[model samples]
Target: MLYAYLLSVVRTVAPIAAGWLITQALRLGVTIEPGPVESLVTGAFAALYYAAFRFAELKLSPRLGWLLGWARPPEYPRT
Candidate 1:
């Protein structure tokens, strides 16, 4: 659980960090001052991108591995 939590944190932070770095680099060549709304939009987009990537990763990986197997499967009672 802790490993999964850490992985999630890393995934969530990485894109934001990269975006910040890219914006800083662009600042050297261009005068771009983003407003609060623009920053919020950018952050939301980054979070969506991370979620999509994580979905793809979960779809690709096997279900019976050590990472996923740590969680117990849901039990649905018969109707």
Candidate 2:
């Protein structure tokens, strides 16, 4: 479903954004290929961002559910 695809994309935002920032910072005033350190730090930052956003969405659904891939709470069926 498109919703699932959207969630997948949303989930990557944190890692991608963090990687970009890290790359830029690492490249400052020097030229060097990315290494394990960059990757490890980026991964950690991504995980933190993902957890925080998901927590916020959980605690404040409907208001911030779209932050990082929330399936949205189920709705009751009307009779």
Best by lDDT: 2
Candidate 2 lDDT, 1-79, residue by residue in tens = 6776787898889779987986887789555567966987898899799778777776766656566656674465543
Candidate 2 Cα outliers beyond 4 Å, as residue runs? 1-34, 69-79
Please provide, for model 1 over 1-79, each residue's C-alpha lDDT reduced to its tens digit, 9 standing for 90 to 100.
6776797999999989998987987788965566866997898898787556555545754343334334333455543
Q: How many residue pairs clash in each candidate?
A: 0, 0
Candidate 1, lDDT over the whole model: 0.66
Candidate 2 lDDT score relative to the true structure: 0.73
Cα miss at 5, model 2 (Å)? 27
Task: Name the weakest run of 10 consecutive residues (lDDT summed) in model 2.
Answer: 70-79
Q: List runs of model 1 lying over 4 Å from the truth.
A: 30-79
Question: Model 1 compared with the native: what TM-score?
Answer: 0.39
- Displacement of the residue 40 alpha carbon in candidate 1, Å: 22
Give all TM-scores, in the order shown: 0.39, 0.41
Local error of candidate 1 at residue 60 (angstroms): 16
Question: lDDT of each model, Cα atoms only?
Answer: 0.66, 0.73
